[model samples]
Target: MVKGKATLALELPLPEEGTANTKQERAYQAIREAILNGLLQAEDRLPSTRALAQRWGVARGTLESVYERLQLEGYILRQVGSGSRVSAVMPDSYLKAVIDFGVTSTPIGEVPTSNPTESVRSETVHRAQVGMPFVARLANPQLMSPAEWAAHLQRAMARMTPDQMCNAEPQGALALRQQIARYLRNHRGIACQAEHLLITNGIRHAIDLVARVVLQPGDHVVVEDPGYPAVHRIFAEAGASLVYAPIDEQGLDLSSVPEAVHCRLAYVTPAHQSPLGVIMSATRRLELLDWAQRQGGWIIEDDYDSEFNYHRAPLPALKAIDSVQRVVYCGSFNQALFSNLRLGYLMAPPQLHNQILALWHTVGRSVGVSEQLGLAAYMHGPAFLRHLRRARQEYLTLRDIVLDTLQKHAAGRYRISGEHAGFHLILWLTADQDQDLLIEAAAEVGIRLQPLRGYCQQNQLEPAFVLGFAALTRAQAKTASLKLAYLLQA
Candidate 1:
């Protein structure tokens, strides 16, 4: 057997006076330079915390802190039993190459190009293409079993009649509408019949139908400040003037709504406030319903992702408490099941049923009969509940992993909110930190984040970012959290 070469201790130079402000900074710079200059190869083991502390004449705690910073920055990897090793891929390699063309090191899995400009452009594009964490409505596709869905589709197809194939209902298939009514009654606590529901392509389509039917040119519409941009666009395109309402800890602040403003429609994500994630308080919910009833206005309750409530039993939907029939309850299977399916439904008020159906007939194409039938069949069977249970458990695990890692690694660096429900949560940063810079830094290391300001209109909310946890795996949650914590604390 060949003898293995004995590993040698890393010999880093001590900090000189006036060179670095502190020993920690100096030591950090030195080790970072070693890795960047190829003096320390990837996967090379480093001395233990105690050994390094004694070797460098620093406290063990200081050495541990240094290692943690290095690990957080992706320059090193630390395992409890296996000790610390240089990361297989270095972030500095990419940063250095982007800053100056002096470094020729390529990131792992990237192809090297001879043209410097092309390489930089390609790298910039690649960074832009990184998976962003705050993307809303994203779910782990792996959690959904495609084979089972396909089987349901096959069954629906086999049972399809010629009349059903040739003729499609404008209000969607009866079976699907009936199933959706039952689901809403049971899960959302909304008592409504199949006639109250209209099968829509998604929330956007549902909003569009409501807009065309209800909104007049120059009609005043009340929307949440940090609300869904698509809703704003839809109403705007319909020639409606949008009045912004601020969101508070209790959800959309009804007090902020100008009492003088006679709004025709108020669009809200009451179950899970978009971007901020605070559920509309019970008092606020009643207040909103009263506002609509008194003002003769309508409320579009977009219950986007209420299925994955982790901490407490979910509150009844806003539509559940609408006694005056002023609320239109909208929901989608796309977020819960799959995005590509494009299946959503809305429970319209009885008065607008005919008008909505008429407008839908004019503007919308029926959702595929097979898809509607298959989904109806799926919802009726046991597999759908099993899928929900599995997905909820997986999402809950991911949420915990993210929350725990962030709290442990980056304590006091940030504040968290809207974590009790939904696929994403708000990570409010300190007032002094630049949200954009942190976002840019995160993207450089292939961790994408969205600024909370992007979703707001007029309200000057705190500097924060929305962090989605639904699709992250165990390893991804830890790594991304560490990187994010480093960016915030750095």
Candidate 2:
């Protein structure tokens, strides 16, 4: 008889009393067959040993052996509190079975780990939408060459001594930090030592850490209206009372912020604000800094996608001018290099450095050592600069093509902004057109139009679409624009 805990919700097939193999083998084969047939899906939790044993009319000890074997063979994942789940990356036979079923799977949205195989089937289908092009989706093909990257990885691994591997610092490898320091000083004009810098998984992780270190429950945090939606969620999860600040042509409008609420932190994407591509003016940047200094608050300068400015020389980061160290600068390679490389850095004020470090150790430690070192090598090498130059030029051509197409085809129907920098631009739909209906029309014509309203928290802003042209070639953009123009005209 099965013993100990009560039964779980997981259902499992039972074997007959007089089976050829032992009850244990019968259960194993049944579960294995279920997985191979795609009936037992990946990440599916299994019935507890006690429950399964009771169902099989076998000893709980017998069921334990079966589960141990399956776990050893990489059939399922076993964790302390979470129970067992089917492994996401299955064996070749399981993958073959999935392929035979005529199904396809795409791993969604930069979670982490080895890319799940094309044959690997997930319960949820993540169909590709139109907004993917405008976003920093993936790394360039030329930059991700296996041969070249392997060489860099080899060099990075060789550079790591045995002692360097252990006692891994929560901040990051000093060597890599030094390289990042030099790169930032030369490229972004934000001067900082290795001590002020802390490597994070990405911008989101950095924001989470900052929230943990600086924010308390119900503390006010200022976020841009119609901003990156993810930022709103991050601060909210940290127990912040969010106050929305609207954006103008000069970037985040400080005038819009309510004076009654004392904000402890202000998050800004000054270099290139997402959805609205306005560069914050020098005067506005100074004003923002002054407010932070006066309020005794911190500014998270998200310098994402600042590298691909086309119209003029990129403006210096707010951190560059922050003599008072009120700015906590954040940058990520996900936009510059690839989305999968979730490597980003946080530059904190010296006063908050130790607190941030403490919070990181508790919540955000265990950054991939190889990735840090590999990125360090790539940054130090000539390829980094060479790739940037090529990407900048290519994006410029694509941007011009998009601008010309919109002006020629959809003119008078929409207002465009964000042409100054970044891979995307905003097209505000005029005449109070229904954004949902227009987006559906674009999709029908094989054009993916990202709705601007989706980014807004308060829904007080005008309806717009953020069009991304960087990923599309001249021909692709031209074709897509033709379809979009036709719909807009009607």
Per-model TM-score, in order, reads 0.73, 0.70
Kindly report which residue stretches of model 2 are placed more than 4 angstroms away from their true locations once superposed.
1-143
**Cα deviation in Å at residue 200, candidate 2?**
0.9
Q: Give the CA lDDT, 0 to 100, for residue 298 in model 2.
A: 84
Pick by TM-score: which candidate is best? 1
Candidate 2 positional error at 10, Å = 80
lDDT of each: 0.75, 0.71
For residue 168, give model 2's deviation from the true position in Å.
1.2
* Residue 387 lDDT (model 2): 72
lDDT for 67 in candidate 1 is: 79
In model 2, what lDDT does residue 18 have?
Answer: 55
lDDT (10s digit) by residue, model 2, range 1-490: 2222112223555757554236766776677656545566567778778777777777989878877756643556789887777763333432452345322322112111222122122222122232344442233444445676678878999988887687686789887799889878766767677877999888988888889888877677788876876677788777777777888766787877755556788999988887688777644665676677556678999988888888544555778757556788988887777666788999998777888889888774758888888888988889777777888887787778877887898888888888777877888888657888987887677676777666766537677777877766567767777777777777
